[model samples]
Target: MQKLSQTQFDFIIIGAGSAGATLAARLTENNQFSVCLIEAGGKDTSPFIHIPFGLAFLSRMTNLGWEYDTEPQSQLNDRSLFWPRGKVLGGSSSLNAMCYIRGVPEDYDRWNDMGAKGWDWQTVLPYFKKSEKQQHGESEMHGADGYLSVSDLRHTNPLSSTFVDAAEQIGLSKVTDFNGPDREGLGFYQVTQENGQRCSTAKGYLTPALTRSNLTLLTKALVEKIQIIDGVATGVKLQLDGQSIELTANKEVLLSAGAINSPQILMLSGVGPKEHLAENGIKVKVDLPGVGQNLQDHLDIIVQHHCKNRDSYSISLALIPRYIKNTFNYLFNRQGIFTSNVAEAGGFDKTQYAADIPDIQYHFLPAILLDHGRTTAFGYGFGVHVCGLYPKSRGEIRLRSNKPNTPAVIDPHYLEHLDDQKVMIDGVRRARKILAAASFDKYESWEVGPGPDAQTDEEILAFIRKNSETIYHPIGTCKMGDISDVMTVVDSQLKVKDIKGLRVVDASVMPSLVGGNTNAPTIMIAERCADLIKQEHK
Candidate 1:
């Protein structure tokens, strides 16, 4: 295979993940400019990857995942749970369940408040629209023709209608679109899928752009460090197949390497906390304290119940043929339960006494998820994953050493804030209320988790302490805000403040966590960042 020796690409995108793929696609849409995308993972060619229901299988497979384990979380009784990220073309987006959540409208409005200028709902909404092919069609809140397709859950389970009814019974308002003008209520989830298949950024953005003559896609090229010269990014040193190679950036280098790797790459290239680097024997090029700080993740605990009579959607010995039929249906027609995004349906909501925005997000899965991210679990049970959207807990990501191959120290100090634990406890209580509603009475036999007898808040809290896990949404490793935000790596335009010709465009740039799933917003950042890069050159 030939290697890139020229330092003349119009743009060089690091990490062909959600944001990087979109950036490469959008920027290279024209034939005039050359765009190069380098990914450490090989091609995304798994059949399970395209099937939404296959999320269960793929979540456990290591080929499509950069499976990471957190350092023991002392707050959670010292458990180092798994954290899987996509290493393939669309990155995590390809491996993820493909939930299409834009978070709260106020989230963007608050971004404007937090010194992220022009990122308010009105300003950012167009970018969201530009990247969407909504199932609900174009409206005041959605678009019809975009790079990504947003569709309703075609494989709806009986548990969905029951969950919605139970949520309403517990006083949560029912809604249709969680990403609409008003974002406070329970509703059917819209996913990033097309014809029942997962619509990853590789399919949505990169596929079309790859046809462009100026675009280049390189797989298995691991970026070791950004090559900085006099406080400006000039190129990068990449290690490919045990061989070191250097490639220059003619115009600019965009680090869409995601929250974890972007900051890791920056620190390895000598551009982070001075003392931290010196301690590791790496000379500091830039003393940016915020290079890998302000990490946030949505923590959730499942509440399970054993159904009585024919209530729970558990299959039977008689249902084996149906399951087999659905499997073949997905293999051939790309439709059926095999395409089920187990989080079949859910919504955003908050109690009356809760904060202004919807603080709690829900994930209602039809299957009993005994352990999270597991391809298979026992029993015909269901899970209600309630998470605090904007948590008070703040964590950080730091380098273990200067080695790019060395996984960074990812510590998401979960439940560090006493308030965060309290909020999560309250979130668990709310989920229990919905589960215990009259709508759920039909399914009630025995409480599968925490058991029906443990009703006190303390028991609920204890259950959360024992079983709560990350919902796999991590952000804020390179938060973007204002100059006063001395700890921040990127400014409002997402440019590395102290480094020229460099930008970080991934979940890491989120100043604060959004109210829902991060995939849609991450791609939106790429769509917007593409214009920002072009404007800089023009």
Candidate 2:
């Protein structure tokens, strides 16, 4: 470990999350340049993080997770939704459901259309392939040998297969591989796992690179602000163990602090809207209006059902014996229910109003997820998560107070747009239809949520308003765009506008949210970003 006393490096990357982990590992590969990776959270030594099924318990771990709550949303009956982001080494990748989904090609092409040049699907697919070590071997679309392990689930509940079968029975085609050419269909989801264990970026990238002398990793170091001189980022001010310290970046200061903190850091460092900065008692340095704007997330609502069959995995007194057996099974052989990623199966489909691509995504869980898996329901049941992939609503991340310890105010402005409400309603109605298919006739008992009483559009909308929660994919707060884009915080190369030696290389730099999960796309972004940085600095 490099001591804090050594306060300078060729590169300083903040937030040891998905992007930072990848960038740090990739940038230091040559050993010609020294890199520093700092994380606000402690080391990812939690045993639960490495277990696939441990997601059930990881959400309640306040220390390992950034358990942030959104500002009360007016559209959702004035409810504050909880969003759990990973505060560990791999960031959300360590805490996420482990679903390895990349959005459709058109999703990235849309970014090209939105002024993010060189980021079209054709151009970005290489980066996606570059970081993947697919279990099924290499294809034109997948890499066989790479850092991250992408594979089929080691064990999947029969209920998960039933969900796919139910979708097929409802006239939906069954897709064997979602990351292949076609993305719209029902199928089992591949996960970021290796031999039934989670393969977080920390496992794929950081752990291997730790042996290299050029890389320095500092954990539990909270970066309070960026030090900008003459509109150029030179270093950062971070607090560690109640002591403040400063570290200089000889070449560049890369902000890979995910979506929320990346924007918060930018704003705190005087690189946000001038007016908001003044109100927060921050000195304006760049006056960029797009620092925390263009916030987007997938708000999902689940349709739960009561299962008549107890064979399926669910919470019940009868399952205790099975649970004990499964625990032993996992400890002995690393197989069984312990290998399940909860949301073992899912699919994507376009709604009637979708524009050229699928607009709704599904995550079929063998067990019900209540309160983001915080509350345990006492019964054997299942849930189908329905989310509008292309949400029309936009929100922002703003400073509640100038203090770095204060959590930023996140207002997703969910369902604020009328189209978002309709899409979510349609998605739920579609999910209901799939669950009602004849494939589940034997298991069907009764609808546990929104029931038959919530049939009409109004009733369904009301149900959604009351029960919707974030699917944990948030992006586009420090959006990348063309030079002409007035709201762009970073250019196409991810360079902060009007600032030298600074870049934002994370989900926040995405011009728009992808069609599915954000983790895979974030890794791809960092893969390409590492190349960009090396090419520029070499």
Candidate 3:
């Protein structure tokens, strides 16, 4: 075992992900403070991570992500669903579908109403603009010179456009931009990409910051726990290449390990619920009851169909020639089928149960996606993924053991509430109507999932229970709230309650789940937190 000569830094960031990478880059921008970013996984140098279409195969690669499985959900036929989170330099941003969506303003406004001060729609909008570099240039709503590139997809399947038209045919408006004022409509989603390549946080933020003299990056380092002394976080003890090392944080220890790991790290550090810690045989440091509670995620159900036309993406002997031709097109011009994000088009709309804002979201894929795209399905087909935007059901993440490496027991308790189940049924029925529209008449063949036989509400609910999965947006494990709330782990400023020099800067700090894709919102949270930290230090 070897010991490091230098063991101190102004800030120590755990998990070099979307939030961590942004914080690391922003904190070290002035070179006045030193930062150390530690990641459990190795570098994200894989071609699959850079190429947009390569997302189809990312779920199968175990090394790049923590392939977590939820505990058997009683509400979903007792199925333990797969949950994949990136462990590499860019974290989930490198593995995500790259949909750059910031949910409507009401989402943030609700956060403020829920006791998270200074986090309303108007207050957080600047942070969203500050972190984005829109392809269409600067505006009141977007920034042109940000580090994270946001651009239109260089290529998209024709069926994606048809899906938009189908929505319009059903009286839904064709929204040009989902981020604009009017968000409830169908549209082709702009992605977090540049020149047809995925612009992960590793590419957009961390890569440029690597040359800074005051910044340090340690990959393949497993953080065992945070070291707290007298109710104050001092440093972290980690295992690096079979060697134990301790790195002290002079200013603060920022936990950006996302929803699951961030809370798990705090628990492992003995800063969680007293009873749970005692049960695990670990000495409790801070008895915070909300360390791993208030778990929220978007549960999705897919409505698939067989397409008579061969235009949809399919793996077969007939398409091999086209794939070969498109490969060269992408290599030379950075265009063609290889540039498609697969779930290229989507929409937001209100259901019968919605009061005002959209209650459901859609992601239309020009191919068959079964088992999180892990299972290969041949022939021409398409699918529309429907998910209720706001679910009342809540779940928790708990420690299975005292060991840091042991994966946490995740139980989302999806559809535990009757309202969530009803919304999902409505969402599926809405998707069926869109597919049945005239715009898809030429290509549509037959329903593949929740097929013609499952038309009734009971049948649809049963199908949802048998087939639903997470849309990869888990959050609120370590929620930010007012001090009066006993379950609140962190405050509005993101500092842990009653713990000095410790903060959580990730999706884990969200008080409620946003209405759309979470990648852009997660980046926005870090951008706002960076300024808050800088102000405090100054």
TM-score of each: 0.96, 0.98, 0.99
| C-alpha RMSD (angstroms) for model 3 | 1.1
TM match of model 2 to true structure: 0.98
Task: Identify the candidate with maximal lDDT.
Answer: 3
Clashes of 2: 0
lDDT of 2 by residue, 1-538 (tens): 3366578999999999999999999999978999999999998888889988888889888999778999999999999999898898999999999999999898899999999999999999999999999999989999977799999998988888888988668888899999998877899999999888899999999999999999889998899999999988999999988889999999999999989999999999999999999999999999899999999999999999987688566678878998899899988898999998999999998777788889999999887777877887667788899999989899999998888889999999999999999899899989999889888888856897989899899999999999999999999999999978789999999999999999999999988889999999999999999999999988
- Indicate the worst ten consecutive residues by lDDT in candidate 1: 306-315
Q: Rate the local accuracy (lDDT) of all candidates.
A: 0.83, 0.91, 0.93
What is residue 134's positional error in candidate 1, in angstroms?
1.3
Candidate 1 is scored at a TM of 0.96
Cα RMSD (angstroms) for every candidate in the order listed? 1.8, 1.2, 1.1
Candidate 1 clash figure, as a count: 1
What digit string (tens of lDDT, one per residue) describes model 3 on residues 235-337? Answer: 9999999888899999999999999999999999999999999999989999999999999999999999997688899888888999999999999999999
lDDT: worst 10-residue window of model 2: 1-10
Alpha-carbon lDDT of model 1: 0.83
Error of 3 at 30 (Å): 1.9
lDDT of 3 at 403: 94
